[model samples]
Target: MDARFLGIPELAEAPSVAVVIDVMRAYTVAAWAFAQGAEKIVLAESLDDALALKARHPDWVALKDGPPAPGFDAVNSPGLLRSVDLGGRTVVQKTTAGTVGALAVKEASLVLCAGFVVAEATARILRSRGCDSVTFVVTGEDGRADEDLACAQYIARRTTETTTDATGFLRRAGASRAATELTEGVRRGAHPDDVALCLELDRFRFAMVATLEDELMVLRPHDVPSPTGTAAA
Candidate 1:
């Protein structure tokens, strides 16, 4: 199957199997948390919703939310996740784009979380599962384009779909001046440590699944890691 890029509205109409990318922090951090041993991650679209989930499952999971700069939980920093002992624990998080993007594509048959941090891993899983078609969902920020598209482009390159013309999107968004910024630069504005984490190609071996249980969207990481521990091809 070919790969295509779709916005939130288009995403709502696409087929079931799809890959969601929110690289700036949401999916990137989620991948980090899972790598650190987090059993699952509850994704909330709003800060209040995430906090409320914690209120209901205080003993069931941990909460992290707020602006991209990090809040009570220290922003969406993948670096920070690695330091914590998530072992068997779950994290309930809300992000500006990632969480909302994942929730937007809820109808997808296979809604896997993705970003530059885990692009290679995500693709390998999809290929192993015999997936040929993909629609990369990029969560727009406040109606404006965000770094999510960049992440999507990064992963889309590994799929059967033609390579994404990242420059085209950047030019269209008028963020061309920020071209030199790259992934690390974009991430630094939010969480420098996390930017570094997102750049680690194929650091993990497992893929993350966005699942829903009791009306809450959660991420469940696989037990086995990828053979190469690398990102998308």
Candidate 2:
């Protein structure tokens, strides 16, 4: 299978299988929420949207938001997600990157969620389903490039099947700038612990993919048919 990079527009136009990557934290938090036994996930494109979902499903989910600014619940930090009780509940998540990316790929045939936390599982799910083509849609705070590309590289590494040459996109996108900024921020006493956590790969076994139910979009684990010729549905 060949890997492709698609901006939101292209993603909206073609509509094929896609893996949304938001590793800096939205999907990472989703992974955490699932680990905490969240029954379902709703990835909203905006904070207002997420809040509205929370308003409707108050008992089932917690509202989590993360904007690009500091000191806002709209920020994407895994540690913040752990501090809450999401046990057997759902999360109406609105992150700057993840949700937007998810929304962008709404036109895709299969919009399976992907991130560093479940990179390997995601790859297995994709391969098991025999995804011959993939579009790595990177959503950002304001549609920025860095974090998503980092995640794309992670997914690309696993998608390659043999070697982990994930550096192509990173190098092409000049990931060093963000690397520097991240390191400097850590040196300046900003979220050093989180910086470490974000870089770790495959620390989970879950896979969250979007599915349609009564004309609504939602996330669920990749429990579909396996590529080993076994029925999973």
Best model per TM-score: 2
Question: What lDDT tens digits, residue by residue, belong to model 1 across residues 53-84?
Answer: 66777654444533443223445666656677
TM-scores across all candidates?
A: 0.75, 0.77
> Residue 183 in candidate 1 has what lDDT?
35
| lDDT score, candidate 1, position 32 | 79
Give stretches of model 2 more than 4 Å off.
12-14, 67-75, 141-144, 163-192, 223-233
Q: How well is each residue in 1-233 modelled by candidate 2, as lDDT tens digits?
A: 77876655555464588888766656777876777677788777666666666667657564444234321233456665566666677666665557777877676788877766777678777766778888778665343567666677667667655456545544433344434555466322234455445555667766788876655568876543445655442
Candidate 1 yields a Cα-based lDDT of 0.64
